[model samples]
Target: MSRVSRDGGQVLPFYAAMMACLLFAALAFVAVGMAGATRSDAQGAADAAALAAAREVRDNAFKGTDLLILTPEEWEEIIRGRRFHTAGACAQANAFAGTNDATAECAFDVPEFTVSVTTNGTVGDSVIPGTENMHARARATALIEPRCFLQPATTPPPPGGGGVVGIECRDGTVIIVNPSDPGPLYKLARKLFVVRLTD
Candidate 1:
């Protein structure tokens, strides 16, 4: 009778090694996929925030002006409500294509809101050339809101009451002010407005 060979045990180690290699490869692939997905999500969020900020500027801030005028506190308030942390406001004075116009650039003095959100998941990097590490930026711009007038006074005249006077009434007209010239009311009304994001 032939004796059983002791070398049979070697087959078991070979199979085990192969299994381990396959498992490691699978894990590596999964890790790569997860990183890619996170980057995509961050990009989408950044784009949305930028666009929303711009819309706010257009709808409420830039009216009949060459640039958007927002105080540091006001800018922070608007950005914070939109889920963005603002740093400060600044004036962009560089001469560049498409951005040479004052209206094309935004100034940020703050550290947080002025910073850019990168695909690498870092926030607060300036988009400016020499100020790259100084601030972050989100730009929004549009024409002025439309215009509508309040109704004329309707209060009755004293004594003889010849005509209406001092009778304040809300105008039914919905004034659509041009995005360029929002006028004085723009500043006041913008304070009450908030920005919301959608999927």
Candidate 2:
């Protein structure tokens, strides 16, 4: 009976140790899950900011030829103002904006992002050459930082894995001349745009 009691005592410690290990493992799993959730939420916030910035740029460009006339400094100021206003407003609306890490808050959790505009003014060649005009092109790019824990799981297996998201618009005037040729001379423009996202 003494031997049996000693063995039983040893078994109790072993069982207690095993339970502790299991508890630790469970806590670890919960931690990882919460991290993933936070990452996903951050990414969503970034996406929203990026899209809003792009749209603002596009809408402003569509207003007229101001993009063509503005000096480099003026253009930069305009772009920055538009970008920050849009981003700030959107970020303020989102719950995650100011709570994250310092770096993330500074960038609105978008580590790398871009906004660009291109304008082209040209004279058309036509039967009545004097009746030609100008054209303009504009584009915007916004790069968002990927969420830490969620990217690996959600991103598709490679080849061309990652890309950007954007939007574009163009406006110009046209002139008609020559009854026979009926040359319609005007501005011709095109835009390539994208908007990136993760589920």
Candidate 3:
């Protein structure tokens, strides 16, 4: 047996310090990752909420209006993105935000729908102080653009009667709406509008 070297105890302290550094680095990385995930969640909620609101407005544009009596000028106005109902749009935004575990505040300005969201989750138990209660927030806007145009009929209808007309879409799809049967046109309201998320 021999006496222990003095360097043995010195190496122990060095190893202990190295382990502490590594632990701290790992905790820091975790904190950063948690914060990033929270931010992403908030952004996703905002985008979905905005898009949902826009889609709701676009879908309801044809509601409460008699499609059979739509004049050429009225059709033009609708296809020009100047007509749409915004009723119940903000409700849709809030519903979507709830689905994504967030809360939304929505605003509408013509064809644009803006939504802001705060994530339900926080960056919990992070290395940084007070980050455990930090919640992420984000905002998004969506637009509803009309993709179809009306091709007015050459011949006018009889008195108090609606005639057949063609709706030409940007995708080269032509929809013929007949006064006898306007069901198909009513169902294709989604094709008439293009809803998308924006900056």
Candidate 4:
């Protein structure tokens, strides 16, 4: 009976230790999963902020431009993602991040807008120390790519000045723009530029 009791006591300690290790591992996994979820949320916010900033620039680039005075070269530049200002674009990034429960810092480099975001909420309570006060951060970049270029008339100029321009697009679509009218140019500008996120 004494021998049997000794063996049982030894087995009980081993089983208890195994259970403790399993509990610790499960808690660790929970903590890791929480942190991953927070990181994913932060990344989503960053993507939204960056895309908003880029689209803001794309949609407002020709606000004050006089399309009638634009030369073919200038039109080419516009289609190449130039002639746009970064003013008010970061505000858009901030607003988008806020909508996702985050804060954003935006940087503009010509056709690209980079946004870094931090989640407003922490990872909450976890088995990992210091995670309760930790917030997830992520970065994303969005690019404004010009999809159309000015295709000047191949024919000779007429006695009267030409009032219409031809724009050739990447998708094999040609758009005719009357420089005297701002409506078509503005609408065409939106189609000429495309905003997308980068990994």
Q: In lDDT terms, how accurate is model 4?
A: 0.85
Compose the digit string of candidate 4's lDDT tens values, residues 30-99.
Answer: 9999999999999999999999999888888787777767766667777787799778899999999999
Please list the C-alpha lDDT of all candidates, in the order they appear. 0.35, 0.34, 0.83, 0.85
Per-residue lDDT of model 3, residues 1-199, tens digit only: 3347777877899999999999999999999998999999999999999999998888777778665666667767867878788899999999999999999999889799999999888889967899979999999999998888876544323335567767888889887766556675435678788888879
RMSD in Å for candidate 4, one decimal? Answer: 2.6
Instruction: Supply candidate 3's per-residue lDDT for 95.
Output: 99
Supply the global lDDT for candidate 1. 0.35
Residue 110 displacement (Å), model 2: 15
Cα distance off (Å), candidate 2, residue 149? 40
Worst 10 residues of 3 by lDDT: 152-161
lDDT of 3: 0.83
Off by over 4 Å in 4: 154-162, 182-186
The TM-scores, one per candidate, come to 0.35, 0.40, 0.90, 0.90
lDDT of 2 at 164: 19
Q: Considering every candidate listed, which one attains the maximal lDDT?
A: 4
TM-score of 4: 0.90
TM-score of 1: 0.35
